[model samples]
Target: MTVILLAGGLGSRMYPLTRIVPKPMVPLAGKPILEHIVDYLNTRGFKEIVIAARYLGEQIVRYFSNHPHAKPVLLDSKDTADAVRLLGNYIRDHFIVAMGDVICNADYSEIYGYHLSANPAATIALKQVENPLPYGVVYLDENMDVALFVEKPVSLEAYLLSLAYYRRRSTSAYENLVNAGIYVFNPYVLEVLERNPGLMDFGRHVFPYLVENGFKVKGYVLSHRVYWSDIGRIDTYKSVMWDLLDGKIAGIKPPATEVSPGVYIHPSSDVRGEIRPPVYIGREVRVKEGAVVGPYAVLEDGVVVEEGSRMVESIVWHGTIVGRDSVIYDSIVMNNVKISRETRVYSSIIGTRRIVSGELRNSIMEPVEVVSPYAQSA
Candidate 1:
């Protein structure tokens, strides 16, 4: 079975960090997010995989070459559906489609088997999240078929009123079952996509069209043990990082060796500081004497923590240097950043390769490319 991974989005929400790197290339647990997905798919017995990428897709292509199991399809268009539509010829009868930015613990083998047995035109993986306003809520009938799809209503009250007016009012009970950005679809669904050239997203267009046209679209509720999250926003990214360190997220292991109880230090690093548990120090990292790191800190490869500095609940990226007497707490420092001595950084997202010398708290510091007002829109 072929797996289609959509990685073509601009990822404006994760800007500055994603200004030079694509969303899939964003690091999670010391590896690219897409690498974990590929590892997950490989373990599930799915061999052939194709990635549809645009908007700095070259980084992805360069990172993973044309291997037998993994192939890259650099698209001219940025639309998700268009990327999938371009690969329609490669898909034989059925295919697995997933968003690149999402990380989930759903069992692909079981989901694929369920789809094959039910023989539906499309099968969407659904998960019940606390907040349904930000997602497209799916209403499943008694037979587990998709009865209706609501694409993120402006207000929850409006959605409830519309739901109360529907013929199958009881379907509101399943309002929390939002789309998980994962799907198993037959060639017929792709045919439906081909008919509408402007259709761009599965939740916004394809899934709704399938239900409206009387096509059978089923929903598969994931098991409770499964974990799912979208690392699109800065807060979510930081949360996911801490989750990984705390062992809250399964199947994502940091590449560092556990030196002490919860302290993981890479073999190539030079450390002489005090490192608390639940810390991950990557390769070639330098921790000078009198520096205190840890209790949820991650220093990626080539990072330098100078003397008398303290870091806690922070993620410092590759090649970044923290000077003497500096303190960082509850923050995310992007790649190649340099912090001068006596600086204090907390609760912020510092962009790639920036130089910081002052005390910044409860603020966002993005790179030059993401500082302009038009950067978010672009």
Candidate 2:
């Protein structure tokens, strides 16, 4: 089956991070988020992948163009409608479509199988959310078919109550299922997309056209409760990390968290720590320590923990150094950051190649330190 990934947005919500990088290029765990999706698709036995791109689309082009399994389509068009129209020209058959920003936990195989068998003009993946007001909500029929779609509503209680009612389909007044940004569709859906070029939304535009025209659009309830999140803001980004740290999501077996008895290390890393499973080291990374590493901390690759430094709940990036007796707590240190001895850094993000050789600093990167947080602090 052909899987289409929409990677066109400018990702305005993911500022600071997205300022220098595209959303999909933003790193998660250790690698870029886009790479993870590709791996997910490959694992589910899907080979043909297409990415729709814009806004520094070259990054997307540059990435997949080099990869073996990635087949990309660059769309330097206006809004969502034009992008979809462009894709329709190529995806003339049934295909799977997903948003580049929506990170998911469920496998594509089951979703694809259901779409094939159901033979609906479109199959919409549904997930019940506690807060549905911020997103598009699709109302389903008793037969688990889509009846109507709603964009973000201004009314709050009506929205929440709608979701509450929709969640319990058997006794509810209506069946409300928020789209999980996953869709499966036949070529006919593409025709709708092309004709309604002015309607720039799938939920607000094409799907409603299906309903108004009496097309068979089915809604499949997602069975697995997986870790699904959109990494668009700093808070959401923090939430993703916290979720990974807590092992809340199943499908994403984070690297291999084997922090020794008193250690806390990430799974994909190698560490020689004083304490034994509580240590968190990131992918292809290493840590050598007479240093007290982590009861809880993350070290990205090429990070060095020099002798006798203390760190907890802190994140250090590739090539950063934690100098001897340098105490870092609840902070993020970027790549190539060098901390001189006996300095104390807490609750801060130090930029890359920044030199810190002072007494104590709170949430501040050194100025002549030559490290700018935008570039230095990855």
Candidate 3:
């Protein structure tokens, strides 16, 4: 079966970072998040992958130009459902549609099998989360069919209604199962889309239409052990990074080699400083003498940590230079950044190609100008 990876959202929540790179292109461990998703799908025996991209999609196209299986399809549609409608030519059979920004260790084969047996028009993947207000809350019937789908019940009345329904069903309030953004659809669903041209988003329009119109839409709940996250916000992005490093996420490996227990360092890196465990140092990374890295740190390829600097619980992306005596804790420094000496970056995000000096805490620093190769070519 073919898989359609949606990578076209504006990603407004991720702001400056998304300005240079799309949400799906954001690096986690060493590869792009989309790459990891593709790898995961490949491992699950799904070789036919189509990435539907827009909003700086050329980068995605260029990235996957040499890839054997994953292909990028640039679309002009403004919404998720529209993107799928535009790609209707590619849907010849039952297909899987997944959000590009979501990463999970979900069993796609199992979901496919369930969909086949249930034989619903669509099977929406569901997962229980602590907070359901930020996602599409799904209420399943006794037969596992979707009874009601509420996309972000932020209103008080909506919350009360959901609470009442859960109470009637004897389900715990905290046990809120949300739409995991993975769907299996029958080809007939495209006919429904053709009839409703204005149906833009699956969450906002498509699923609700099906449920209200008496179409069979089932919910497949993921197992508790399955790890999944949508890297849409800064906090979730950081949390996912930490989870991947801590080995909570399975079936994906860090790009570097584990030199010691919990310490992964690439062979090309030149390390002369003190490195605590639970850290990853990538290719061509240089950790100078007297610097203390880790306890939870990720230095991507070509990064340089100068002498006397301390980086703990931080991620420094490609080609960034941490100046002498600087302290970076709980921060994300994007690619090619240069931090001056004696700088303190705590709980902050430094965007690409920036030059930083002084104390930056609880802030977001974006570059005055972005000189990207994509921009140049465009």
Among the numbered candidates, top TM-score falls to: 3
**C-alpha RMSD by candidate, in order:** 4.0, 4.6, 2.4
lDDT of each: 0.82, 0.69, 0.87
Q: TM-score of predicted model 2? A: 0.80
**lDDT of each residue in 1-378, candidate 1, tens digit only:** 989998888889987678877888787756778878887788778888998889888777877675557888888864777788888878997889998888887888889999999999999999988776677678888889988887767778887666555525644345578788889998787778788888887788878888988999998998768889888888888787777777776766677887776677889999999988788888889999999998889888789999999999888877789999999999888877789999999888888768998899987786644321112212
The count of residue-pair clashes in candidate 2 stands at 19
Model 3 vs truth, CA RMSD:
2.4
Ranking by lDDT: 3, 1, 2
Report the lDDT tens digits of candidate 3 across residue range 19-92: 78888988788778999999999988999999999988888998888788898999998799999999998889
Tens-digit per-residue lDDT, 1-378, candidate 2: 678888887888765445445677665555567777877777778788888888767767766786677787788767665676787656657898888877787867888889889899989888877766667787777787887666666787776676566555543244445788888988777777666667676777777877889899988777647657777775676566656556665655445454444333555556664642344576556556677766557676667777777887776766677778778887767667788988888777666567887765556553233322224232
Listed in order, each prediction's TM-score against the native is 0.92, 0.80, 0.94
What local lDDT score does residue 17 receive in model 3, on the 0 to 100 scale?
A: 76
Clashing pairs for model 1 are none
Which residue window of length 10 is worst by lDDT in model 3?
369-378
Q: Where does candidate 1 have its weakest 10-residue lDDT segment?
A: 369-378
